[model samples]
Target: MSLPDRKEAEVRRMLDVPHPAVPPDLAARAAERGRRILVRRRAVQAVAWALLLAAVAAFAVWAAVVEPWVVPPADTTPPLDGW
Candidate 1:
């Protein structure tokens, strides 16, 4: 019983050991990577927006010149009048 308790205590102590702190340069590198990711994201977003605007402009041009939409003339009287 005593031997098992001693081993258990030793295992608990080993598990509680403090981990080494991260190096100062590691934090700077992480910040630099984050900035790069942000820049890439912004660039991708700008390209996506430009593509969307171009598609909208193309659709508008198509609707205006190639496939023109015309409204039918209104009927003078109602279709159903009496019960």
Candidate 2:
């Protein structure tokens, strides 16, 4: 037949096949692995947040001390034309 018919027949064959028996501890092992992955992800996120906060705090302290936004007034010496 055509490609669609062949694809339908293949899907039907796949559905007709019996599923394999799963191991009893498979769910428990998967749950444990998921917990570990979650813990690691949370820890990494926490570290990233802490580092970002530290950088912000340091920048704030530096800005407070330096006052980088303000410019100093210029001083000009008297003219020495009579010398």
Candidate 3:
């Protein structure tokens, strides 16, 4: 048989067998694990947001103090006027 037909027949043969018994506490365990994963993900997200805010605040403070956008004064003086 062709590869696709052979794969399909194999899948059908596997599906025909009886399935294994599931653990009684499977749902509870899954729910608890999911809750823990969700909590960890949320905690990480919160920390990331806090760090972003902190970085923004620091940049704001730096910009306020430094005023980097303003042009600097010329270093050399003009020639003496009315000499």
Per-residue CA lDDT of model 1 for 8-74, tens digit only, reads 9999999899977889799899999999999999999999999999999999999988656677568
TM-scores of the candidates in the order shown: 0.61, 0.77, 0.79
What is the alpha-carbon lDDT for the whole of candidate 1?
0.91
Question: Hey, what RMSD does candidate 1 come out at?
Answer: 7.8
TM-score, prediction 3: 0.79
The Cα RMSD in angstroms, rounded to one decimal, for candidate 2 relative to the true structure is: 2.7
Off by over 4 Å in 3: 1-5, 79-83
Worst 10 residues of 2 by lDDT: 73-82
By lDDT, rank the candidates, best first: 3, 2, 1
Give the alpha-carbon lDDT of every model. 0.91, 0.97, 0.99
lDDT-wise, the better of 1 and 2 is 2
* Candidates 1 and 3 compared by TM-score, better number: 3
Question: What is the C-alpha local distance difference test score of candidate 3?
Answer: 0.99
